[model samples]
Target: MMDASVDFSKEMEALTKDLVGIRSVNGTAGEREVAEFILRWLRSFPYFTTHPERAFAQEIPGDGLGRENVFAYVHGTKEAGTGPRKTLVWHGHIDTVGTEDFGALEPWANDPDALLEKLLAEPDLPDAVREDLATGDWMPGRGACDMKSGDAVFLVLLTYLSEHTDAFSGTIVLSLNCVEENEHTGILHGLDVLDELKEREGLEYLFAINNDYICPLYDGDPHRYLYAGAVGKLLPCVYIHGCETHVGQCFEGFDASVAAAEVVRRINYNTALCDGYRGEYTLPPSVLKLADLKPAYNVQTAQEAWTYFNYFVHAASVADILAVLKGIVKDSMDEIAGRIDAEAEKYAKLAQQPVVPPNFQPEVMSYDELVAAVREKRAAAEAKETALDDELAAMAHKLRAKGRDLREISLAIVRELVRELHPTRPLAILFFAAPYCPANTLRQEVAGEKKLYDQLESLVSSFGEETGEQYKILQFFPSLSDSSYLKIDDTPESVATLYQNLPGGKTVSPVPTERIRSLSIPAVDFGCYGKDAHKWTERMYKPYTFGVLPKLILKAVAEFL
Candidate 1:
């Protein structure tokens, strides 16, 4: 048995150093080398076995860099009459978002040992300056947190678990995939291959546990959060083409960049339209880049052409939501294009004028299982909110008469109670409302969005499983805008009517009366990438590491399995 008190500090330091040294940055196609190294290490273990041949490879367009996915497994003991052993998938991606200077910070080359020691000494440092060793705090190198730490944690846990096989109830499937930080193509391809293998061997799996963002320690805090669900991503680009002219002659021809800028402004600043899918739709500022706007004939002329590129990253949006968003983009683009063309035609009826052809491409979650995951999360959230309301009601009675103004005190009491009850509201709401929500919807649309998401997920999963190809999909919904707890309508008769429609949608005997509490968004924020992930000096709130992540993973695994 492995020592429960084994100090992993040293081992972790070494692993981090080793990973940082590899320089397996994304975009550069260096993950293949790292993946090969990881496979060799896994094969060296007596209890673990790598695939019979190369598991999978990472392929980048025009770059013949040989990247690969590594798979290792350990069998479980079975009873005499039992059939095939069940499998538990432990998956992690080996790639990291590549650094600008590929060779700038090779791990452990220069004073890495000392840097590790310094980091260990100040484990509670803030995330911003933690990875900067110049200030005696820093997590040097890329992929430290965005997830080399997660990969190391998996190895450590697996190594320990393998040594104590008797303690495990089922077979372990270790999957170290590539290209997660870029397009997730490596993992998608690996999953396809794994499905083929499963089909050939007739293997059944309980569930796949992805150790992508598993953090063991966090800064000090009482409550911890678990990630029951992750919203899918939908990245689309909008291109606007128009007749460009000199800045001084702006009135002659429509400026494509300016016209595109209007559309972006509408998407960002127009709340009623954008926020209509409250808790579901989020349209952040588009990344506007001048794609093509140059001098015509090498001389300053009023007649010029330009193109504007708008890159949008939408979160948790489903196919229907994407369609709606695309429609909005199309309409906006057409309106702007038409206005520009109309204005340009008035000035000069040039035979060939630039046009804004609605060109939109979506980058979505490449698996149906991911969509089902969001549905599961939504259901879980609904259930949790229901249970929390009950607890808050009980707590409210206890604080009814504490020498405070009843009405004012009740509001304050409810606010505090709601915050306590739904701590994840902020994060969940942001996910649902901003990035995940769709921009367009018919006012008459009713419930069944959840069902729609589940169906889409099932379809995607079925397709992936059947075809052995990866598919990306999205999930969308409406968001509640309020930051406070959802107001529970307290009208006596209305309450009775609400309970009557439970479960079967038919009136139950003796309809119970209860207040209908409104839901509120929680308050949690994640800094941009390169800000929070692993660095030799990376630090997180103690509560996040110890309390939230562990509890979240444990709960998710328990529920999923």
Candidate 2:
């Protein structure tokens, strides 16, 4: 199956140690360093030395840090005498989250052995962590588990496939992406690279294998698993507007803060909104951000506020997310209005004044409708030569250039639109925010795909029986990953809803919906097991990660190629 002389374990351990020691945290110059290091390592091989074009670092289009993704292509020795046969892809992100959580271990966090030694001596270590350390099987350090281990596995696999072309039937394209921890700029650009390569080289894409980190769903988890699909993420943002009034006139008007709390109360960790796939359910949506848009705090009631949520989806479309969110916003606003009306009548009766109910009719609309309504109203104002939309766009551009975050830019634009449109009081504007990842799965309906899936399941189970390495097969990975860029399970028409509804929709990284949809690359997540990914105690098991994972991944990929 492979060259008996080559030591896969030694190669993996050496590469992983070097990779983990390089502080390639997302949003730093270390991203470039990791890319350069990978390129050099790839070029060291005889195959790449003769074909240097197969190994190089590609710069992402708009990365301000000049970050790059390493690309290594290995063509199979088996040829069909046609143009180029089929190709399988191996994709992994090389970036890691920041090391701030390491605290006292920050100095040694990049050095796994030193960090493990220090951790073993610390009397204050947690009982569970100490137990894992005592076993002498886990390597603790930053990026050791979250995914540098996976990256090293892919690198070593690339070299192995290069040396033993007969191990796989077709060619292989292994890509180490950057920016997955933040904006996902690398893989987004990589979609273009694959498309161009396909056109120029006539290589048909078969599938992609993403080696993101895998972990026990809980402590003492005994079974390892692989997934056929990965989860998708969407951000449903809400901008709340209220009638501002002085604290003395509190009951006379509705404060946006009052409505914001009700929204969170109705939405926080509500499991009913979740979507399930192939016998598994996605984690329920939760608010990642919520804040009032008040500039300087005073006694005046908060008039404008905003919130955005982290929503994971399996089969839900952009339209489905918008509909569910719109329904929630409508109900939350209605309850708020009814409560304010009741309070206004009670306050009047208590003051011995004329009894009356507050009549601020609640209005709710989607971002698309709001923009259109604003356009309709602003046309009249622009008759006197004022371009409302242009003004907001320019302001957002300036703020973004100043390195302001997307959520802040989103809030500013929504606030400006609501303030100008003046859509009465007690209003809610619902919209989607940046960084929308679409969910995809193996296309069972596609010819021969179901067979491949079945073969993989059977092979993994038999392999476990043969080697005593246990694993359960999952239909989907339960987290977000760069594998999202591999394919589109949804239609192009359905994804346009996301493109239209994002704030400053034209400014964000554009997903070529039609182009990506055309390339239906089945994806899977198979990688090393570990725990506490971003914590100071992050670690991966060396026995399985180094000794067993590479062989298993090679076998699984051979089935596809």
Candidate 3:
């Protein structure tokens, strides 16, 4: 039970409002302020103050973006004399996406109350959404729903556990991490913290709980989900290198954007990729970001263009994802080749002139193959030289250490390599970007894995029986989460093969696959209820989010511990 003095609703509301107002948007001066505030808040508690070692902060060094991760824990009586005590981790990311114009309340950037008032008054706000706001039931801002609410919930629960340690019998870990909006580096920090904690206290991790926002089923539906796994995300960028032509002779050369657009047409919102598991879980590929890779306004038929997609996967591995992306590139390029050939035929007929033969077929090559070719060429050129430069070695060290700049450098190298190796052929290179988050689930193939999931189901069922409320075990979390960082058993050889096959593999973020797999802990995403996650209309339903969700968390902790 919670302390009678603590007003859970009011505290949550105040915390949520303050947190949402803080601009912890990814890539800017991100998460540092909010994380410092959390550390200070943790110290305010008598328990943490006395055991200050229990709370700590870590910096993810190579992030280059200056993001930090925070962690704290409340120890139960049993933890002091632990042989191997169970631990429950409450993890939440403190980062939000950009604060684009918040529609009518754009001016209320610093004032959350003004923003909430405007949200309540806006005529365009849907009735179902507005009605919920009227009943002490709204939080509006960038991070309000897409998870400051979850942070508030975790804080309250952690505080409660601290105040009433006798109610539970194991450690409750609080991880208020950064960079979930982008790289998911905070969870990596959490893994480090867990390792240290395990070494110090000899504790065993039981489950990780990520209280992300869970959107309602529909307008009026109040039911929420308890997700066992998260869908993986891979952003595969397709670079089209075309032959430039003067504007007057535009039909003489193909535009790179034409080929890029065709790729988008074949991929964007395509339902065939949305394969379902158990005929219920599905995540289709969507275009998160795309643009013509040109600078300034001079139009020379765009010699090069690129577009990346928000490709999602449920049961697929890196190899599976690469195969699908390769297939899409091939099919789109084939169609583009036919279109270009048709245009060439039409141009020849109209002008009765010698039309430039279109090299519509695009050459595709993996990053490894390109790198190997570049190495061979460089070796031959260097064979005549006797000495290596010290400056080049220093530059190599810098590049490896600060990998954030590798993508552009790799692209430049690939372009040069292509010019030297296959001067006449146009290239359409498909490759992954930074931050590869692989999908993970509690597989029941092993007896231990089966037991854990079965126990969770039984606990949820027990809670449902007590409250007469229905609960569901969601097969996959619809959104990407930090839980993807938790390691699983995957072959290093297989991961290496896939990595080598990726077109820009050398530039992609080096995901420590084996390290991640070694620390794989099962996780559950039981979060707040909201809608319009990344939009101006984003708001968390207060009644279910602030009220019932906390109780569910408390119940789960009690049962699991």
Candidate 2 Cα deviation (angstroms), residue 275: 0.5
What value does the lDDT take at residue 30 in candidate 3?
51
Poorly placed runs, candidate 2 (over 4 Å): 1-7, 345-354, 379-399, 443-448
TM-scores, each model vs. reference:
0.53, 0.94, 0.89
Counting clashing residue pairs in each candidate, in order, gives 60, 0, 3
> Which consecutive 10 residues in model 1 have the weakest lDDT in total?
425-434
Q: Please name the candidate that would achieve the greatest TM-score relative to the true structure.
A: 2
Global lDDT scores for all candidate models:
0.40, 0.81, 0.73
lDDT tens readout by residue for model 1, 21-68? 676766455687788777666666656543334223335333346677
Best by lDDT: 2
Q: Across residues 1-561, which tens digit of lDDT does each residue of candidate 2 receive?
A: 554335577778778889999999999999989999999989999999999988978898766789998888887775454656688888999999998887887999999888989999988999999999889889888888879988898888888788888766677888889998877888888887888778876788877878788888876678888888778888888888998899997777778887887788777799988888766788888888888878897999998888888888888788887888888888888898898888888888888888677777878888888888888886867656567667767887888888888767777787778777886668898888777777877646666667767877898898788669778877677877888878777666667788667776656546666677787777888878788888888988888888778778777666666
lDDT of 3: 0.73
Tens-place lDDT digits, model 3, residues 1-561: 544334477788788888887888887675888888888888888888899988878877765666789889887873355377778888889999876667557667435577778877788888866776677566667888989989998987787788888877778888888988876767765677777786786667887888898886765564667888777666766777877777887766767888888889998888887755555555567776556667877858888877777877666566666677778887887777778778877888898977665756666655565556656776877655422233333444455566534445444445555665653556777766655777776766768767878887887787777766577887678788887777443356656755664434433465666666766677789888787888887778776677777877887777777
Q: Which run of 10 residues does model 3 get worst, by summed lDDT?
A: 386-395
Q: Estimate the overall C-alpha local distance difference test score of candidate 1.
A: 0.40
